[model samples]
Target: MADIVNLRMARKARARKLKEAEAEANRARFGRPKAERLKMERELERAARIHEGHRRETPGEEA
Candidate 1:
């Protein structure tokens, strides 16, 4: 015979587990330090500026 389980406790436990999983996911997603994120953003912006600087304009393609 299977042991009886309390439904309320089981439900609460499951909710706790799901909440923990979401928190873990959020930590991984947004875990970068502010300085590191800012540095990355600056590097990306510099790269974009360089890329745009190197672009050649076609005479007939003006929009």
Candidate 2:
């Protein structure tokens, strides 16, 4: 005896496969990944400055 499968389940499976295929294609075209980007280092330096500016507490200020 053969087991019957639901129709809706098959449609959902097809949609998920198509989305995965598109993501793979995009990765190949972009070439260098996020780790290799020069901008990453520059952004890190900029963030450090902003946080340091906020952390300074003035003398005699109320707790």
Candidate 3:
């Protein structure tokens, strides 16, 4: 025979789990300082620019 489960408890558990996951994600996204975020964004842009500078031009075409 299979075990019987309480549907109300199961539903509350699922909701709680979802809320916790959302809170964790929010913490990661909003926990950083503004200056640190700006620094990271600038670094990423600089790296992208450096990468773009290293690309090769195709034959008979301008880069």
Candidate 4:
């Protein structure tokens, strides 16, 4: 004889798995600390400013 599975139990198990996956995704998307994020933003801005400073202006280009 073959073994039988409960339909309700299987459905509940699937729902639990989906919920866990959603939670994991949410954590990954919002896991960084606010200070760390702000520091990264500041670093990017500083690098951009430095790059612009190093750019050479052409004689024909208008300021």
Per-residue error for 15 in candidate 3, Å, reads 0.7
Who wins the TM-score comparison? Answer: 3
Per-residue accuracy of model 3 over 1-63 as CA lDDT, tens digit each:
988999999999999999999999999888899999899899999998898788796457875
Instruction: For each of the candidates, give the backbone clash count.
Output: 0, 0, 0, 0
Per-candidate TM-score against the hidden true structure: 0.53, 0.42, 0.63, 0.51
> Model 3, poorest ten-residue lDDT window?
54-63
* lDDT for model 1: 0.91
Q: After superposition on all CA atoms, what RMSD does each candidate show versus the true structure?
A: 6.2, 8.2, 3.9, 7.2
lDDT score at residue 6, model 3, on the 0-100 scale: 98
lDDT of 2 by residue, 7-34 (tens): 7998899888999888888776566677
What is the Cα-based lDDT of residue 24 in candidate 3? 97
Clashing residue pairs in candidate 1 are: none
- So what's the TM-score on candidate 3? 0.63
Order of the predicted models by TM-score, top scorer first? 3, 1, 4, 2
* Ten contiguous residues minimizing lDDT sum, candidate 2: 28-37
